[model samples]
Target: MTEPVDEGLVIYWRPLCGFCQRLLEALEVAGIQATLRNIWDDPEAATFVRSVNDGAETVPTVVVDGIVYTNPPPDQLVIHLQQA
Candidate 1:
């Protein structure tokens, strides 16, 4: 029997957020595959994002499995995901 592998990280952000754009660009440069969820398009996602950060609608919030990162920088996020 094989253990189930995690499906990588999920990033919740908005298209117009500069920080989100930076994070995306960095992820692209690092060749990382992250599930990008735009909160603006999905109300549930927006609500979820807010829930993760005490009702703060901060973009570039990423969830690695259940671990939440509220607006973490690109490099920091890279290291964090790698360790996960």
Candidate 2:
């Protein structure tokens, strides 16, 4: 909700999204630094999520180095982070 990121990892989420919470927790445990964008709070963020999800507002959408991932598994996200 603060600012959108252009590099590294950006996690688009909503506060009430369970999957988002889970992913955030996983990132924390993995010591991954990611910019968090709350889609519910930012209309542009929601639109971005929709664009990447076939026009559906899917929370926990992750972007790394401009690459978008829709609801990636926690372990897979970690792997992506490592690759980033």
Candidate 3:
């Protein structure tokens, strides 16, 4: 898959992460468009997540307009989406 573009939300996640699922569902419910990148499936994505997460692979890492947020609450994400 291609690297995420700079214009929209990009979520770095992993399988079996409840938080990731929750965030995805919330985004859908809120009618927000975001690109979902599974860390397990993309080595570059995993590395990016690690770079911001103290060298650990953390799920629900979100990038929006070049800003990074780790495990943000759904409401917080919605606010950011609206701002964008």
Better of 1 and 3 by TM-score: 3
lDDT of 2: 0.85
lDDT of each: 0.79, 0.85, 0.86
Q: Cα deviation in Å at residue 30, candidate 2?
A: 0.8
Question: What ordering of candidates by lDDT runs from best to worst?
Answer: 3, 2, 1
Per-residue lDDT of model 2, residues 1-84, tens digit only: 323469678999998889998999999999998888888888889888887788898878998887788888998889867876
lDDT, candidate 2, residue 60? Answer: 89
Taking the tens digit of each residue's C-alpha lDDT, what string does model 3 give over 1-84? 234447578999999999999999989998998888899998889888888889988889998988889999988889778876
Question: Evaluated with lDDT, which candidate comes out highest?
Answer: 3
Off by over 4 Å in 2: 1-5
**Residue pairs in collision within model 1:** none
Candidate 3 root-mean-square deviation in Å: 3.0
Model 1, range 1-84, lDDT digits (tens) per residue? 111124558888897899999999988988889887788898878888777778888988777776677889799888876776
